[model samples]
Target: VVGAGPAGMTAAYYAALKGHAVTVFDMMEKQGGIARYGIPEYRLPKVKLDKELNSVWQLRDTEFKGGKMLGRDFSIDDLFTQGYDAVFLGLGAWRSNELRVPGEDLPGVIEAINYLRMNSEGNPVPVGKGQKVVVIGGGFTTFDCARTSRRLGADVTVVYRRSRKEMGAHYSEVDDAEHEGIRLEFFAAPVRFVEKNGRVGGVEFQRMALGEPDASGRRRPVPVEGSNFVIECDTAIPAIGQVPNLDFFEREQGVRKTKRETVITNGALMTDRPGVFAGGDVQMGARTVIECVAQGKLAAKAIDRYLAGDDMARVAEEIAEEEAVPELIDIVPYKPEEPQVRMPMLPFKERDLSFQLIENGYDKNAAEKEAARCLQCVCPDVGRCHLQRLSLEHGLTDNRFHRAEPVDYHDYEYDFSHDFILRDLNKCINCTQCVRICRDVIGANCYGLMGGGYDSIVTTPWNVSLKYTDCVSCGACAETCPTGALMMRERDLQTYELDIVRCIYCGDCVEVCPHGALGETPNFELSTYGRFGRTVLAKEELAVARTWKPSEEIPLDGHNSPRPPEIRPPGPPRWGD
Candidate 1:
């Protein structure tokens, strides 16, 4: 077994579990390759990584050796001669793509992968006296580089050849960078790097315009002649892309390559040579860590089949079936009414000079609240309510189970400020359905997790209310709310009514009420009104009623009386106040 990334590690674990004498080798000292190096600690913490790596370490018959470059230390022939029945090449793409420009070799120029790896390892690069830094690319790497520079006391700017909408990075990541004061210049292409005295100085760029849709369906960027401009900066980080290092395969053992220069593999990921297989970034190009894991597992199964001398045709069919099936859970049609739990962020000022983690992970309470918002898509309970089913199954009329610590509902003022839906923090259950729908489906970063712990609650940048935020009022959040918490405020009529009198202290109303309007109260005077017309009152109305009283009047008996009649002002309306 070779490589130590998620894919390689997973493959090694399974191979060992299956009783194969596995020996893993990697160039890095640690087991987690790109994940440990490329990703930021706040995004994928080392502790979580250690837990995963430790799981791999527990596999029997597995031996891990780090800091061993495959071709340099041993060749494919050496593995076959060592009595290993099969060899798996899981070497991942660790090389950074070059800009191929004039000043790319300047002293201050850097690659995204190296920068992230260094910083994640607590050995950050030194930025010279000048405060300006520029990043060129349009993906997650670009944002990571820019954000890292911002945290290192640089006034960072991102230069992309495409428009903001065309950015390939997660919208939330881009928004986070912007929130930290990272400037962006879109419709721009870097022409050449500007350097002085053997040091980086600035970048010359040309204005670009969107052209007709290319073969990829995206509008291609066309450089406008005579529109070149230069921006001065201390450093430039190019994060255009990354590719697999194929030198080991080529030099150590003559393995064939695809037209794109990746290793050529067979139906089961076996290279052109026998008893050798490859997978992960080296096979699928640079992709998500999850994808790498899936590939590694596939390679392991293939390796097992080869070792057992099973028919390759049968393995191909199985692999096809596995690839055809979707990985996401089939959730029921239930809407998620919970508000998104906010991820805590570092202050902008401090962000300029500190590499401190930005987002704080959710606590247990916050995790449970956020998890409750899941729609459980494709499950039988999709449209039907699971909480209701669970309550019925357990014969629970009241919430006798542990209650989550209460959040300060009043911190965020209810802004009837939007047309489609109302945002009332008091009613939100910390479900992230709205955030998911907006990001995954709509590709908009309008909403995101903010704050931390109990204080954490989803919000837009600058803490702008939904109306003032970039919300297009698409109603997706309302559509997926399991409880009526985030329902469309403009619905012709409110279909549900709260019967606080018969509520029996059951939180069904609270848990299912997405709007946060129906809340817990110490005063259950809802019993005062007749059972048929119990009403739900807004906090404001309740506050006003507390201060109301009848004006002074004389009694018909003769003397003025201080006491009022026992008759109560007719109880509140049935629907709501």
Candidate 2:
């Protein structure tokens, strides 16, 4: 693993989980690349960051080596020579983009990343109390610069060429920065820095107008003629964007990079070099922390496959198929709507001279309430479902044959009649697995493909309930079901007592037995035979078992008589064995 940022650390952590030895290297003396250095302490405390990063290091066979610059200390070839099977490049984009304007090289014009890194390390830039600072650009890093300067008692102003909606930073970040008294000037682009005695003094700007949408789908910024202005300030910081510094990657390595300086990778995140992979900012440019973490996990999976002697091309194709967005299912579960929980924030007065944390997150009660609102969309048999796996493997998503008329569609009623099994005929693909398993294996012959043409469906005879059939509650049908058309019902185990008296002799009790455990007294022992390798009725309980004549009228007091206990069923080899 290279560059121990969120992506690198995540890859190393996953690799270690696979029982592979992983060594994480970073240029910084500490781990957590930009997460630790480029983010302000108030936003993410160093202590908490260290605690989280330490978890990756604690994994078995995982090692962390800091202060190892890629090109300066060691090259990619050096790693292969060291006997490492695969190398993952999670190097983050750290070099900030240039303003390309005159006087940008002035002393007061600080790099946003550098300023944040220095401040986080306890050495803030020279923006003293009551000084004026102008922040150029609109992004999370731009806001960080403006807000951090505000904490230092500087009169800060943020200039952006785009409107608020097009800004890269979240609305909450902008709102908090405004609440902290930072000024915002939109629809303005900086032209040059105003010199003040050989140091930065102010920035000249040109008013802009939204033009035609660009490749990013945002309106391009067009300079307005005769709309130039100047914002007086003592310092200027531009946080437009960042690109990966590829100086570490030698040209002889055969690793390709885009014009933007991001490494080029295939669908599996593998670079041109067979054994090398790149992800996160280095491959996809700067992205959110969560996105970087996801890429890291994917890279780790690819690396594992590569180490296992899998063909890279086939692995790449599989990854591309897995990453394809599947057409959305129309199943909409009804859930009551609830208002979102509002985050508590520190008062603006408290933020005047301090870099205290904002957004206190959710309290325990609020957290639980928010979590309860989640409509979990995961299927119960998600990982085990063969149909789902095949759907993904074949990319069988969107159904173009969806009929427009409601009469053309068929929706079946779900059958919950069986106590131990749930039958959703709607989910049946007519695979006949349940039919064959029941007839050939269990010999119950409870299911068959019924009807003709498109209306045909696999179901019990006469489309009756499963309990009404000759099912033995063996669960072989559900086990063999590729889709969740048939499934074992989940329930808590409970003790059941069958009264020896009140002998109506209607046989209704035996008829409703979900597991088919209740039957003629002579064959009753067989139902519980393989289930837990025990008998449903103990010797003491069976001694009292007796049949009453139909003419006998039992006393009401006989209702308290002990009966057969509810036994755990469908044991080894199959349910109900």
Of the candidates shown, which would achieve the greatest TM-score relative to the real structure?
A: 2
Work out the TM-score per prediction.
Answer: 0.62, 0.67
- Backbone steric clashes in candidate 2, count: 2
* RMSD to truth, every model: 21.8, 15.2
Q: What lDDT is obtained when candidate 2 is compared to the true structure?
A: 0.81
Which pairs clash in the backbone of model 2? 570-575, 570-576
Cα-based lDDT at residue 142, candidate 2:
97
lDDT of each: 0.73, 0.81
Top-scoring candidate (lDDT): 2
Lowest-sum lDDT 10-residue window in model 2 = 568-577
What TM-score should be assigned to candidate 1? Answer: 0.62
Model 1 per-residue lDDT tens digits across residues 1-577: 8889888998887665455768888988888988888887656778888887876564445688999877888888888898888888777777889878788888888888888888887884855334898999989888878887776778888999999998999998888788888899999998889987788889999999999999879999999999999989888889998888776555656567765547777768888787888888888788888998988877887998899899776777766654554433444445635569886666666666665667767776787778778653422223345465556668997856434545533445776778777766655556776676566544445777887676667666667767765565556666655555566774534366756455533233443332344576775332222234433444345444344455644223224434433223444222222
